[model samples]
Target chain A: MTQEKPTVVLLTADGVPEPADLAEVRDLTDVRVCTAGTLADTLPGAEILLVWDIFSGALSDAWHAADSLRWIHVAAAGVDALLFDELRESDVLVTNARGVFDGPIAEYVLACVLAHDKRLHETEAFQRAGQWRHRETIRVAGRRALVVGTGGIGRATARLLRAVGMDVRGAGRRERDDDEDFGHVVDSADLAAHLREVDHLVMVAPLTEATRGMLGAPELAALPDGAHVINVGRGELVDQDALTAELATGRLSAHLDVVVVEPLPVGDPLWTLEGAHISPHMSGDVEGWRDTLSAQFLTHLRTWLGGDEPAPAVDKGRGYVSG
Target chain B: MTQEKPTVVLLTADGVPEPADLAEVRDLTDVRVCTAGTLADTLPGAEILLVWDIFSGALSDAWHAADSLRWIHVAAAGVDALLFDELRESDVLVTNARGVFDGPIAEYVLACVLAHDKRLHETEAFQRAGQWRHRETIRVAGRRALVVGTGGIGRATARLLRAVGMDVRGAGRRERDDDEDFGHVVDSADLAAHLREVDHLVMVAPLTEATRGMLGAPELAALPDGAHVINVGRGELVDQDALTAELATGRLSAHLDVVVVEPLPVGDPLWTLEGAHISPHMSGDVEGWRDTLSAQFLTHLRTWLGGDEPAPAVDKGRGYVSG
Candidate 1:
């Protein structure tokens, strides 16, 4: 006799997978798709939850209704959105889509670094004006880069930077010996000191209590003048006002893929900042991203149903994968 | 007990070093700086010629006046400016500033590839317009690139592109086995076949009968649709009309640092082509480049004065340093 299928709740928002795309998961589970408005109504008695709408706060708002929820799989690398007090204290397991974004995000970070050093923006402006002004461009080799965060994305970024002949250093929660890509992995407490030496500062750390607002006034001040800041991680990891002030004075440059507010207000000062390269928060996104996310969730679901531990299990207390 | 120093004529244009900057070379030779109008007057008796003005056609115009000229050192990489039949048939040894631009040009090529793949131009446009449009970007890693030319600049470009995770193949005068950076090396005759497989085609070959007008309509048509063309070699190496036509139809894109009529006429269709990223011929220029050129020439001058063959002796027949 076949075992009975368990209830699987899929929380979705714009650009995520449709019910038809999740037919693979539906074959093994009783799938119920929910939007922000219907999440609370469908959360009760669900054994599994796929947080496809990572930006939605519905999961936290309806946490009390998750009486039968045993596992939560986020369709993103970050778990900050689902790391509530109740979930942190519960026995429910959390898994994230980790490996899918490493290569694409790392490529994006390197692209920003190259564009800034090569003065591509100025070149484009000259092209548009039909002016020919020749200028010297900086070399990427032998430059120093400090990657904040030692996760998959951070390691990938460090590797690519190093491959292009850069001296790369990484920072994690605690101090460790050199890894394959980074020369040394220092403790987060020493980020300020490292900031002074690097030409580029890349923020790829997760959004947690210890990291939110990490690059406020003092930390931003520690960076050498003319240093570029690249943030592909959470928006709240930096203080927007302080960053704006620094950029306005032309003391520092920034390539921000995320801002404190998504769909940044039309009137925000960042849009007009000469030193900023702002893009909508889509750094890790590549073609067929939705299909990739759905496939990753299905792999985890198959393992979870077979009573085997799924890979990339996140530590609720630590807010990331431990190893 | 002392011998008379050789007369060294310095040809200069816009960004070339001034007489004061050539003091080191002056200490070893009787230095005579000349512009276009004065070049004919100074060319008669000079034993050495420093072609700082690579864009000037003065060398070819006054070749008959070079009675005592034994050697010519060009301040630029390409020797197209000096490749007159009279010089090619004469005994004057030619040398060029070869190593100086290898790294800078390679970095520029990689920068353009990254900018194109990451859609940085679109991102900047969105930032300027204060529009928050989220779009998926292309990843650079594992993409194919065809780097034309097997010389220092082409080799350097292949290395940097490969370092960024590209599957790089190089095309030269003839086919060869895989080198350190390029996985396969094809002959220029087979470039059309290779063009169909690559996402990026970087042209860094020197201007010569073998390479001039290489990327004409037939070759451009062979490239995969949406493939990006990067030209840093010389303007004449590509057919501008063919490239502009392809770009107009949105079938291909280009990052041209060199153009047929640079300071590309204000009304040129290329400037208005949405797919073209046009810039002045400044791919190899960097800060303190003039100083670097002077130093390189000084080093070569010292070797020439000692009667030992100065390094980087160019083969007049081939128009570049041959192994």
Candidate 2:
């Protein structure tokens, strides 16, 4: 007696996923594609939900319609926005795209650090005005970096920074002395104390209740003058108001890929803030990323269909894939 | 018998070096600092010359006044502009600030490559316009880079690029299968044939008759479309006209720290070229770099005063310090 195929819902941010992207898994499941507005209507009988829209919060709004949902896969490294109390209380399994973003985001963090030290933006401004002004740049090899996450993404960042000769440390739930990537893993509870010595404060922590607004007013003030803040994780991981206020004083510079409110509200001061490098939440979405992400989901889907659990199942209670 | 201290002419581009910067060597020598207009007047009776102004070509014009010159030390890695046929034939020994620039310039090269791959300049433009456009960036890791010139700076660049996971190759006077920093070293004589496969073509070759204009029309035409050209080396190493023509077509992008004309003549086409990133040759001139450069010169000066040869002397005939 064979079991009936599960109905799969592909929730997207805009439009629908390309047929070519889902080709390999098309015949194995009953697929239903929908945007946020249609998600509730399409979720009734679906047992599997593929969150293709990384930034969507529609899952929680349409949770009542998820009558038969047994599993959900986020095509992104962070599930901060999608996590709701009800979903965490449910028996449904959750998994995420973790390994795919590690290297790309690590490279982006390094890029932000190098861009600040080398004054590339100022150089670009000079280029625009046809100016030939020469200025001394800062050396990056010996600078200190504090990566505020100890997960896969943060570990990747620490290793890359160390490889480039930076003095790197990690901040996680607890402290460790002999971590391979970060020589000293500082406890997140003591993050403020460590900021005074950090040259680059990189934020890659998932946005959980315990981690929300981790770098607040006190942490911002703790960083050394002229320290660079790079956030490739969720924007809520930092206190945006405090960050903008500090940036206004020119005491620190920031490279924000994710902001508390993305699309960042056109009227936001950070859009024109001096020393604030703003990019639209795309640190890890490199070319052909969607294809890679879909392929990863397909592999996990295959495992689930074959009566095996996915290797990297997300810890729903913690809101991330815990080691 | 006690010997008289040597008279030293410090050729400067604009103002004199700070007295504090020269305090260590001041009591050991007769120091005469002068700009280009005053170089010839200061050259007479000076047994040693220190080229403090990296971009000055005053030495060639004042060579006839070097009545007793025994040694010349350049406060930079390149000796291209300072090298003249008469000086090469003279009995004077030439030494350069080699090791000091290797690491800094290598960091700058990595910065440029990352800047290009990550679309940093474009991101800055979007921020200025209050635009939050999401675009997919290219990955730097696994990308191929061909570093021209196998000198100290080029070798350091190869190592750093490799450290960041790039597939790096070296272009030098000859080809070799095995190299520590670069797995394969390609003969620069066949540069064009190697261009198609390179994602980034970095020119760090010291300027010499053999290498001058090496990346001319044929070489530029051979590179894969969308390839980035970065020149931290002397501008003459590339044919600026050919480079400009290619840049105008938008088939390639460039980060030029050096151009054929210093200050790049106000109305040069490259100043407004869309894909061109022009910086006033400051790649290796990081903060505190001047102090470091001067300190290095003093150490070499002390070695010479003690009757031992200054180590890492430049091969005046080759226009660089050959291994």
Candidate 3:
């Protein structure tokens, strides 16, 4: 006899299945799709929670109603926004869409690095003004890059940067002399000590209590003059005020995919800063990414349905996927 | 026993040695620096000509005075502008700053490709407007690129693009399956037939009778809609009028570092086109490039003075550095 399908609460941004894969997911499980407004009402007795909206913190607010939430699967690489104290203390297992983002995010980071070195932004601006100003550009090859975070995304970034001949290093929770991706991994706690030699400071670390505001004024100040800071992780991973001040002086540049505030408040200094390059939190969301994320979630859902745990379980205490 | 230093005519844009190396070249040899207007006077008895101004076609006008010319070392890669019927038929040896430009131009092309794929121009535009509009981006890794020329710059471009996981092919003078840089090389004579599948059509071919205006209406029309054309070679390699028309329609985009007109004239439609990215022919002119080029010429000069042939001599008949 076939057992009854477990109910799945899918917290989506628009309360609709965007890609066809999400609809297919509905056929396999008792799926109840809802937006943030209806998340609390839909949470009770659902054995599985799929955080498709990604950055929504609705789950934390509706935690009192999670009567049977045995598993929570976030369709994103970072679990910072979704994790809460109550959920971390709970027995519920958390899994994230990890491998799906590695390649796209790494490619984005490399693109930013190349664009900065080649002065593409200036080229675009000059094109707009009909100016044919010729200028010298820096080479990406042999330049030093320090990737903060030793997770899948950071490792992928390191490999891609190294592939193009950039000298790559990493900063993680612990220091290491031998890392396959980053030849020498420095401790993130001591990030300022190593910033002096970095040409590109790439922040891809997951935002946790330990990593929040990790690149504060001290670390930003420690970076060499004319350094480029690329943040594809989270806005909280950096001190935005400090970065803005540095960029204002034209001593440093930044390619920020995330900001401290979503929709970045009107008249914000970063939007007008000459050295700041802002994108709308899309370092990893390449074309067909929604479909890929949904497919990844389905793979994990299937494994869970077959009486097996998902492959990459997030370390609740650490607040990310731990190797 | 001291040997007499060669009389070198250095055709410069500003008639000054901007880099100190050129000043050093003056001390070592009988160096005569002259601008375009004074080239004819300076060319009379010079045994060696250093075309440091790069794109100046003044040599053709001064050919009547090239009585003692034996070797010409261009400080730039493309020798199309400097090559004349008289020079090609004469015994003058031509060498270029070939290896110096290969890597920098390759890096620039990759930068343009990545910038185009990631919608960096749009991101900059959005930031200027202080709008945080999120958009999906194309992934460069799985995309297909067709690099025209198969010379040093083309080979370097192919390698760099492939390093970022792009599917690369080459369009050269002839078709070959066993080519090292590009596994499969297509003949440029059949360029139109092969362009339909290409996502990025990179033009790095040397400008010759066979290559000038090679990518005309037919080739541009054959490209898939929304395809990007990147030209780091001589602008004559493509039909700019046809490109402008295609770019106007938004059916195709372009990253043009070299234009048919250097300053691109006032009120030129290309400058205002939405899809046209224009740079001032400075793709390969990276930081300290002048020093590198000067050092290369000095090395070649030393080799020639020691009674040895300078390496990688340009095939004057074909108008570029050749195998």
Per-residue alpha-carbon lDDT of model 3 for A168-257, expressed as tens digits? 999999899999889899999988999999999999999999999999999999999999999999999999999999999999999999
Displacement of the residue B51 alpha carbon in candidate 3, Å: 1.5
What lDDT tens digits, residue by residue, belong to model 2 across residues B1-323? 98998888888875645534586677889899888999999999999999888878989888889999999998889998899999999889999988898999999999999999999989988888888998999989999999999999999999999999999999999899888878799989889989999999999999999999999999999999999999999999999999999999999999999989888998899999889999999999898898898888888889999998898889989999997
Q: Order candidates by lDDT, high to low.
A: 2, 3, 1
Model 3 off-target regions past 4 Å?
A: A15-19, B15-19, B23-27
Clashing pairs in 3: none
lDDT of 3 by residue, B1-323 (tens): 97888898888887445545766677678989788899899988789998888878899998999999999999888888888889999999999988898999999999999998998898888888878988889988989999999998999999999999999999998899999999999999989999999999999999999998999999999999989999999899899999999999999999999989898888889889989899999999889898898899988888877788787888989888777
Q: Write candidate 1's Cα lDDT for A1-323 as tens digits.
A: 97889999999986665744587888899999888888889989999999898787788889879999999998889998888999999999999988889989998999899898889998888877777787877877888899999899999999988888888999888777757767788887656766888799999998899999888888899999889999999889999999999999999999999999898887889999899899898889887777888888898888998898788689888898877
Per-model interface RMSD values are 1.1, 0.8, 0.8
- Cα error of candidate 1 at position A240, Å: 0.6
Candidate numbers sorted by TM-score from highest down: 3, 2, 1
| Cα-based lDDT for every prediction | 0.88, 0.91, 0.91
**lDDT score, candidate 2, position A99:** 94
Model 2 chain A — which ten-residue stretch has the worst lDDT? A14-23
Span of ten consecutive residues with least summed lDDT in model 2 chain B = B14-23
Can you rank all candidates by DockQ, best first? 2, 3, 1
What TM-score do all the candidates reach, one by one? 0.97, 0.97, 0.98
Show model 2 residue runs off by greater than 4 Å. Answer: A19-21, B19-21
